[model samples]
Target: MVDRPNKPSAIAPAASAPQPTVDIADDNSSITATLPSGENVTVLLHGATVTSWKSGPGAEKKENLWVSEKAVLDGSKPVRGGIPLVFPIFGAPPANHATSKLPQHGFARNLRWEYLGKSTSESTTSGDAGTGPTDNSVKLDFGLYSANLTDEQQDQWPYDFGLVYSVTLSRDTLQTMLNVRNEGQLGFDFQMLLHTYFRIGDIGSTAITGLSGVTYTDKVLNATEHAQAENAVRIAGETDRVYKRIPQSTTSIVEGDKPRFDVVRDNLPDTVVWNPFKEKAAAMADFAPDGDYVHMVCVEAGYVSDWVRLEPGDTWEGGQRLRSLL
Candidate 1:
């Protein structure tokens, strides 16, 4: 964990204007970044999980990320909601694989990450001749390396690798990017995913667009392959499907006729849509207020359809940007 200064340094305000700021918790367990526009984001060092994202400004601010009310925050377990980083492997690993002995979703989301500080950039939101109110954005970087893993975790998947996960907060968008670098002589195969749990008004009234015509594996139906026939996918029950090779990079979550969120992906070709519904939601110890399932949906972006092989000194990068339209 990073040590917080007695008097935390903040971005110096420019000419009495409210500038973007980044605050590390007194205990250095989490960090929060606030934009001048009133939008804010918070991330926990545990798993480098993004726990909150409030969009819009002032009285219109709204939470866009859904975190379970009972999610364990003491570093005892991987967070149940919000955005959890998945790496090395996704889901249960197959027999004899390099990650077979590892737990589901690998160790990235179960370990603490080091804080790497932050950077801020400003852009003109309006007006010409560089005379407009500046829209400020802040990017906070967190890192995890093979050395940071536990002895057991290192033995389970022995490989030298470094991961840098960056979360950027802007006026209306939240972006997350992950960069993976193989730091050893041996090549390794791995999978990665950004499991994002989005808050919604109502699951029944919400529809996901931009996956039509793509083939998907229905995890709920014995991992059977199926084609997506619906232009707008809606949830009615326990749904778990992995859409492979998405034709478009952008997908939207729409409530009624208005889009609530837009997810833009970069270098991530696969997307997973999941909703636990009633029974499974109640079965999970971390998911509180079981019925709250109707208010959240997971639209995850990743390269889980296949493994990515990284050779010595090679690097891989991928990310997603989420924009709140509500």
Candidate 2:
């Protein structure tokens, strides 16, 4: 579905900047704020359920997607943690735990997104521009577009693309842009993940600084016996890995005891740092069932196996930028 570049029929509203409504009880559980020019953000939803994900002033309550907002992508449970946007493919389901059909990180996190409103935009140089749209926050535009895929998502993804997810809260940064549009013509190839579940107050004195030389995929050494960690692999036991290529101008520091989460990315290469920690989080029953594991930490932004090919008219934009330093 990625053939978008022609939206200019009417999206005006950026003069003095007055569009900050964050009161939700119903009315589609609304939210669209902006703080302009320099940027500070806000975006909360309840209908399609995004539920307040702020940024800047030290990015608060951040849950980019993960865990069950409604729980859509099959593989039995899959959502659990936070920052889950694993499109097309991300993990699990070929491990015999495979239900022959669903249950794994698929289904774009259990389908139900449809806010589709709010504006103040800009994008050119072929694409990517902001401070042009406003709900306010220096610049704003919180969009969501999905075409309706259920039936267990056509018996497990047949083919029919067009998933545009835009969460632009501005200033100091909180950008998550993903536009995959290939309206079922015939050019499919997937693999994408944002999976970010970062909250960490202390993971044994956290220290994931910029991922030194990057080259990982050690699912715990591909399941025992082939260990390989050249650098920055510090999370203390039971840390399932999957890092490759990664270096879009790095930065993934996470100091302990509160206030320090700088996971930055841009046109990512691949980075995932999981933590099932105690008996795979008690044999997963919606994970963290009660363990809580120090707070949270998933640091992901992938494109697995070099999968990113959408050419049916084409439109594939990737993102990841969570800058909160305190």
Candidate 3:
């Protein structure tokens, strides 16, 4: 884990104006958002992937997100940690689809995105300061269209589509939203997810709750179906599970007896809980040192169990909100 200093707060008044400002350098490919509350969220255009979200009070500041120490930042490959957006396909693409030629999680996380616009309380009714903690919300939008696709990329999928992804930062929570619009004359099927990697002081001391009785496909067990018998799921080794039909409630990765963070989802019916453990972590060059799994956990939210179908001129939306409760 990268050593980070705790700031006093991530919520406050936007400097100079009420509207939140988006910062991006032409020479640099990364985007940095500074909210009024001293909270900061950084993202890279290469993948439209959120790389860092830091916000909390003094002395006990918290870094809710996590990234691998050895993860490459030069855009050669997908960064191993933080929140990587997955689209078009989840695991391996089906051999029948044109998207099959793409990468494991499709090209959404590997392709660059164009910045749209930002919104804050000053410019909209959504963000109103002093309206409780939620008043500090700030939003940034990034778009990717099929016209920007490379020759090889077009050959891979060939579907004309427009995707606008948004990252909203507030006090303790960082919210993600994806809007998919079909621009082609034909319909297309796709899968999507926000692969979120959370920082854990100790994975051994952490357990997840709010998934009891849910049915899931155990990827580690060769796609066998099973019910979650335990109220709180704990990790002892390599775990790759795809939970289906998840409700729009709160799920959390608790540390010891207390909940450390919360993952709230909407329009997303799938939850992917994974940890590569020791052996797999050592095998991946992107994963730093050894035993890197001991410090992180992934509780992804998406619509992956069944393909989402979108007709021409239609749009679909999905979202996930991450908050640190500790």
Leading candidate by lDDT:
1
Best by TM-score: 1
Model 3 TM-score on a 0 to 1 scale: 0.89
lDDT of 1: 0.94
RMSD of each: 8.6, 19.7, 10.0
TM-score per prediction, in order, is: 0.94, 0.31, 0.89
Q: List the candidate numbers ranked by TM-score, top first.
A: 1, 3, 2
Worst 10 residues of 3 by lDDT: 123-132
Evaluate all candidate structures by whole-model CA lDDT and list the values in order.
0.94, 0.57, 0.86
**Can you write out model 1's per-residue Cα lDDT over 1-326, one digit (the tens) per residue?**
87766966787765665778898999988999988778999999999999999987566689999999999987999999999999989999989999999999999999999999999988877898367878889999999999998899989999999999999999889999999999998999999999999999899999999999999999999999999998999999999999999989999999999988999999999999999999999999989889999999999999999999999999999999999996
Give stretches of model 2 more than 4 Å off: 1-35, 38-84, 87-89, 95-115, 119-147, 150-153, 157-166, 175-217, 224-271, 274-298, 301-321, 324-326
* Candidate 2 vs. true structure, TM-score: 0.31
The segments of candidate 1 whose C-alpha lies over 4 angstroms from its true place after superposition are 1-16
Q: What is the lDDT of residue 25 in candidate 3?
A: 62
Q: Is candidate 2 or candidate 3 better by lDDT?
A: 3
Write the residue-wise lDDT of candidate 2 on 1-326 in tens digits: 78778865887775654443333335543344544342333333321223335444433444333353343333343446545577676676454322235556567665545556555543233333543443343233333343476666666666667776776664445667677888777786777777776666556777676666666667776544222344445677678777677665565655643436566667778777887666776666666444565556677777774667787878788877776664
On TM-score, the stronger of 2 and 3 is: 3
